[model samples]
Target: AVALGVKFLDAQRKELPQGGAALADLVTLDMSGLDPRLGTVKIEVACDVQNLLCGPEGASAVYGPQKGANLEDISIMDSALNNFGEVLSRVANTNLLELVGGGAAGGLGAGLVGFLGAELRPGTQMILDITGADEKIKQADLVITGEGRTDFQTAYGKVPVGVAALAQKYSVPVLCISGDVEGSPDFLADLGVATCFSVAEGPTTLEEAFLKADEQLERAAWRILTVWKLAEECQLKKLRHS
Candidate 1:
């Protein structure tokens, strides 16, 4: 099967002089057997493949449908990816369809790994390393982070958890700001997130809440900063009198 796939690709490569380089940096073929539990891993692979392909748009067209893809669009994108994959196989002797992560983002992840030699790394670890979040926590007076929502999955490398882990290492106070604070607050307390603040003042429609998010965020930040400033001023005044 792999040999036949490779032979088919070689024939297609002759048509494109740049050798499908313009089509995609990588080609992913979506196969059906992917596990759902590996969704995050698959997403990371898809994003990487998108980078290897021309960019996010290429990846989105190829992989976006699995999340919620229409049949007609998926078919068109699939054909494009398959042709690109064939070209890669002919020139590089790499059968992208059989590769892991190849089926990511409709098999784009596999395509990148197979054709572009992209490596798969844990997404959280990559983010932590790149952001220097640990170092930031070590140096900051306080660390604040949050997400759109917090759930059991939050422990599985969500932004809040990642920030809290780093903050814990430094014994820094970590505060979470969320759209809604559901679940037990005590659950997060154990994780070293000192407090979680909900942005909502009262119940309202979804559209109304979204419209006010910017103002609410600013108000919250201002309130926090004002308290910090006032406390600092009082401390300075006391020191001067002493």
Candidate 2:
């Protein structure tokens, strides 16, 4: 099965699927057999999201705004997704809407699952396992992870949280330093993020933040390192006195 969402559902309405059309119906799949050039292949869709299909947290409602989809467009897209989910459920003989990571990359997760019977994998852990990150995290004194933005959503299968899961196994503290930080501090802590902060030092416009990204990152890094050094020294002094 081919991936959808990232390409098919763009700002420009290229070819909107008709009402109640399964995503598979919109595309033609070659089920005759695997291509002769490639031998048996196992399909796996790795994504760092857990949003279900057809809901507020679904792809259209959550990611549409970033893709230049306005209210009218989001509403339309959501309705189309609901209809598509219903049809795919019958064809796949499975509940695509309830599939974890189904909303990923704009229904790409659902597409792969429905059409190809591909496995939905948690991308971060999968990649980290491949990259031997567990060994590196085990040896490191601290683990630093970040994303474009950290908010309530970050708690839901985001990159930083994925890193935190591995680091926590080795009793390593995880610090998240994102371009932007939102949601409550408690919520962030609950996600196993020791601490998190935005790169911006003060109020700044989106354009300004983008332009000053490098400088802002440097300043934030400096601040975090300085505080860390002080904490280390304090610990040393306390040990000496005790």
Q: Alpha carbon lDDT of residue 215, candidate 1? A: 86
lDDT of 1 by residue, 142-171 (tens): 776867766544553456766777777778
Q: How much lDDT does each candidate structure score?
A: 0.58, 0.77
Taking all chains together, each candidate's TM-score versus the true structure is: 0.48, 0.79
Q: Highest TM-score: give the candidate number.
A: 2
TM-score of 2: 0.79
Scored against the true structure, residue 209 in model 2 reaches a CA lDDT of 96
Q: Model 1 compared with the native: what TM-score?
A: 0.48
lDDT of 2 by residue, 107-212 (tens): 8788778766779999998999999999999999888888888877787798999999889888988888899988654576767789897898889899999999
Q: Of the candidates shown, which would achieve the greatest lDDT relative to the real structure?
A: 2
